[model samples]
Target: MSSAEGNLTWEPATRHTELLAGPVARAIAATPSARVAPIDAELADTAAFCAAYDVAMESSANCVVVAGKRGGEVRYAAVLVLASMRADINGAVRRHLDVRKISFAPMDQAVELTGMEFGGITPIGLPADWPVLVDEAVVAAGDVVIGSGIRGSKVLVPASELATLATAEVLPLSL
Candidate 1:
């Protein structure tokens, strides 16, 4: 367990405006050796945030939570992707979750169930049972940047370390 920054008090979104610290942050805490890193909270989206910070997409991990129903079974899945790629929710996710179909979760529904601000959600800290999928390429980038459980804060850690921290399963699933 190796942590990057010791305890840094960065301000996570305090309201429902842009981001909030939730599952992702909790995962950071769960990481035996990870520390939450600071990120500007007013980010519009992952691409914008990476461009503004000069963070390489390959090194930036993005978490997308998707929901859908198949054969009358409703399910939610979180896909951790590289900033350079997209989460192929339609195919890979549909197959992995074993859902006949899948789609991006609606805003209101995403917030209600995730208990997170819209754009700040992360796979970490999600209910223990939710399947979190990580792209193998993303795991190889090392020192990846990801949501801080809040829109404003992000956690920075070695990619390998992140995988270890989350017990994440890696596959070639990113689009």
Candidate 2:
């Protein structure tokens, strides 16, 4: 069901509350431009999802959870960057987090904490304390496709809407 406006086969993300729970569902319901479309679970990866859905790689945002330690305390962050570039974890993110080192969160920790599949993490439903560091490029990408907290579907939303999230911080997060 392609939307007449974007000719994109996206349904309202809020329509699939069963699949996208917690903050993800609430965020979609609140954002006017958010949309969601079902896909084969196996095609949830960035490359596969883009190729199968005819989505531009540059317009696909990936949200990654990173972990680090500072003064015996564990810190976490959720980073949003386009598929075309990697998140600058050692540089931008570390500095933004005021931590000396950071790395991608362990798959188990990420999945358990976010309550989302590994390949389907999104900034929408992240823990409130986790910073949602978004790359400038992603914020300027207009409408982009993002994970929907489940491998079987994806969410589409305006970059501006993502920036409006309480934890969102737009910065040069890509390298």
Candidate 3:
């Protein structure tokens, strides 16, 4: 585990499906290196979680769902960026999605579509058609913290491994 990992005890994620959302548990089962740690649900947001858990902001990654619309058609995607940075939704992401407009997905739509808690969406188990855009910096961070599809726990995995997800594309996605 990275030194930046907080005080929570880590365990194999596959062995603790109850702590993860349905799709997340299934997806993580194929990732042998993934680890899970329980946390207070109230502190699930990036800043609060890092502060209360002694984790470094740079060692954490945030997955945001975005909606891109063009010609009356909408496309959804998941974007991963380090906690220290923000996804360039109107610039890189919009251009990459080839859409006329791009914005953060509404919370209810994101949660319902992803089958994840509002504050704990992760890129691991998104719908197959939605691309997972990973910031290049996140892939280079080594082991980093991410949401576990639920607000009560978190997942730890090698950043490089995320780039290997079938739908993932590594790009300069952050500002």
Candidate 4:
């Protein structure tokens, strides 16, 4: 993966946060090419981080947690889309999950289940059974910035590497 630019310092993602030290870290480590950079927690939001770090918005990706119920069973998913587009949660996600309805996960539930902060939820450390829907546009972008499972840092990795995740599915998930 390409190195992050601006005032950030690149390092193994595992070293940045406890959230990234488990399966998240393992996934990145297995890639052999991923890199993560530490940033001020205050700038973790996509817009602020991109502006402060001099990174283009198109180079960043957002991971959103979605929840849906089917046959009285609740299921969760993490949807990765470029900052430039919105995830089609109502259509694409609902259909993919085979549920009658779907919506953005509640902040408390998401944070609790994923062990991530409200805005720092990344696809990396999510529950193994949760599907990670990656937008085709994001996968085509090559190098992209993503959450580090914590607000204190961000990960720079190849979109292709994210596609390799067992729970990840690259598709037209954006509207």
Candidate 5:
């Protein structure tokens, strides 16, 4: 089954593995509710993709990788927030991670570790140990659009489904 949302046509992501990064494709294959849609790679960023597709900002979610350091150990996590809000990295996240300092992970590090493109990292296929911190608002937003682990396409899934990921923790993570 297929349908159109905004200006994009959506199909089961399992049918478009070529458009997803390896891990993401595998995750989607196991997630029955996820759908995929192709888009111009140049418009993959949240702002550009939302505008070009005529999608509401509140209906889009962004996944950000963050690094927190405590003494000699460093922890990495994926934070999910609505495109209309910002993640509370300095306060809630830093405290939650129990680290001395926390910041957005370097682009190269995030890309290298997640095995996904810089601008298209999604929380679905992150390293098994990484916490997937999802903002409460995002989980309450019903269906939302997110990166597909590749710049040429996007995934649509129920916000609540994200909260069900093994590593996910729904919290007040946004400011």
Candidate 6:
């Protein structure tokens, strides 16, 4: 539970996928209409991973983060982008966040905060205080597939479900 769960620690599954398997997996599981599956961990690239597994690009939500200053505050904003669409970080995001100077957080910081390896930082399992900026496309589509805090695992979830799970703010993600 830590602070959020009142000092409770879940019995985590040893498998990378299992960490999210319990919660995220169960959420999608409730919807009998949706199909749930995982691709081989060997496949890492987006196009290859999607094609090999028959997963659509738009259904894949990429979680990206940037570091910079907003007024007197130093901050980090997490972004949810479609695997197919680019994040207009310097355009829509910069203006919206009112960040005077914005740049991608170094890989080290990313690993430190999220406790997940690079290329596996999903909105799930992030620090409770960090803002999970939900992309409009993701929310509009109603569901997304993102890294599950593990390189070899992913979770499929509805945007609304994710909003509640991460305590995220569903808003305009980018240009």
Tell me the lDDT of candidate 6. 0.63
**Which runs in model 2 stand beyond 4 Å of their true positions?**
1-8, 21-23
Q: What residue pairs clash in candidate 4, if any at all?
A: none
Q: Which sections of candidate 5 miss by over 4 Å?
A: 1-4
**Model 6 stretches astray by more than 4 angstroms:** 1-38
lDDT of 2 by residue, 29-85 (tens): 556678787788998899987887778888899999999888978899999999989
Model 3 pairs whose backbones collide = none
Tens-digit per-residue lDDT, 50-135, candidate 1? 77666666767777778879879888877888887887788877888888878888888877777777777766667676777888
Give the worst 10-residue stretch by lDDT in candidate 5: 1-10
**C-alpha lDDT score of every prediction, in listed order:** 0.66, 0.84, 0.92, 0.81, 0.89, 0.63
The TM-score that candidate 5 achieves is 0.96
lDDT of 1: 0.66
TM-score of every prediction relative to native: 0.79, 0.92, 0.98, 0.90, 0.96, 0.74
After the best TM-score superposition of candidate 1, give how far the Cα of residue 9 lies from its true spot, in angstroms. Answer: 11
Highest TM-score: give the candidate number: 3
Q: Write the per-residue lDDT of candidate 4 for residues 56-151, one digit (tens) a residue.
A: 778889999999998899989999999989989999889998988789999999888987777777888678899999999999987888887778
- Residue 96 of model 2, lDDT score: 88
RMSD of 3: 0.9
- Name the lDDT of candidate 5: 0.89
Error of 4 at 167 (Å): 0.9
Clashing pairs in 6: 1-8, 1-9
Candidate number of the best lDDT: 3
lDDT of 5 by residue, 1-80 (tens): 21225778888888888889988987875467888988999999988998999888998999999999999899999999
| Sort by TM-score, top down from the best | 3, 5, 2, 4, 1, 6
